[model samples]
Target: MSELGIEYQTVLGLPPVEFVHLAADLDCHHISMKVTGGGIYHHPAFSMLDDTALRQQFIAALRDRDVTISLGEGFVVRPAYELRDEAAALDVMAELGVTRVNTVTMDPDLPRSFDQFAIFTEMASDRGMTTTMEFAKSLTVTDLPTALQAVAHVGRPDFALLVDTMHAARSGNGPDDLLMLEPEWVGYIQLSDDTLAQRNPVYRDDSSDRRVPGAGEMPLVEMIAALPPVPVIGVEAPMRSLLAADTPVSECARQAVAGAREVLQAADELRETRARGCHR
Candidate 1:
């Protein structure tokens, strides 16, 4: 009976107000916001975050619309200057009243130990926000080594890794991968679909590339079974078919929840099976 949510990207082209409206239409309880664009030196908000008043107004509007801030995105790991910018992004999260900040693991040009990430974690912790790092097959930390490095360096439960459906599948991470992660290192999980045919694509931003949870061939059910319990499930399907299809965003949101429902059920079954096996 875990709650389900979708990324703001799912309803692309919508501003924060419109995004919340779409979330309401879909019966979604949360929406994610991005913080990066232009360059690493730029703030995570793409200049929109510069206006503290405007950002507060948007945050209030989202609350008024009865939607929770599931997450804030667009974080990058990069050079020294970029690290400062990333820290600034965390500051914005604190001001916006968001509890979690999400970013990717690729070190665009700079490689820092998990200790460096831990620093951001402490900073966000001071502001009442948590830091969640996402791994992509395309990112440098697609394997277990990088994941371990991050968790050990941060040494905090709040600064954790993101279990992404596509990343788990494309990178061949499975039950063993789950065992490798300390429960404390798991902060958030993202659900998406990817097929064997779609597996090595160099690009992932295209709309045609995405499908609803069960609609595509991603092994989401297994991936979910392998993950530790977490607070949120963020559906991030950005298929052009969904965008161009003549359906309401609410319906798509429903579909996202439906997909997650199936995964949760499967995870429950997995636990039951494991329990039975242990007894035997």
Candidate 2:
């Protein structure tokens, strides 16, 4: 099984420093760090760049655990968006050796958003990071084909797409859509499941209500099979119900890893069975 990553939302209330420790304790190979945005945006933290000492401590902890800061979150580009003092976030990312940054577009103008994405990817590349565009049913870039089109327009090697399983299904995409994606265009994938049969009327809540892989009706095994060989899989199930029940973050992380591994194992077994059948 690939090293499963835990995205920040799964343990939303935890401080960034403590979050890293939980991930390390869970033996997570990678973690998606959230440096900015909060409240309705779902991320509940500010810049980890404020305190140099704290940042160093965080880095040391990750290093000791051999965990990679595989992804960074909360970089958004929209019309009339001004690049504020992003130096803090960039500095922290550099120190942590983060490789990929997540971006979302809220601007209604598709053409303008493409130009903005180009600028964002250029900035991320300058800091030795790749920019990954995460498409959702709620976002302007709603599906894989549109995401591919946007990436094509940007024409940057460092720009890639993030396929979040729940969002893919909500956006009316399926395994065939995954097949259509050029492996090079995909950077990594977020694995999760949702019980909703269709897109929610208020899509914002979807982030908090996700289920651990294989806990719901999502065709997770098939989705895994459709992915490229050895894809970097980030388990991003943020079950608010569990959180309300006062469940330990460690337990949540543990269940997420087990569920994801189960999906992968089932997919592998099915593939082997098929291979044996073909030989017969």
> What do the candidate models score in CA lDDT, each in turn?
0.67, 0.78
- Which lDDT tens digits does candidate 2 get at residues 34-65? 66433432434555667667677778888787
Q: Which has the greatest lDDT?
A: 2
Per-residue alpha-carbon lDDT of candidate 1 for residues 177-275, written as tens digits (9 for 90 to 100): 676566787888888775744433464543235677877777677667777777778887755555456665556666766776787788779877987
Q: TM-score of predicted model 2?
A: 0.90
Cα shift from native, residue 76, model 2 (Å)? 1.0
- The true-structure Cα RMSD of candidate 2 reads 2.7
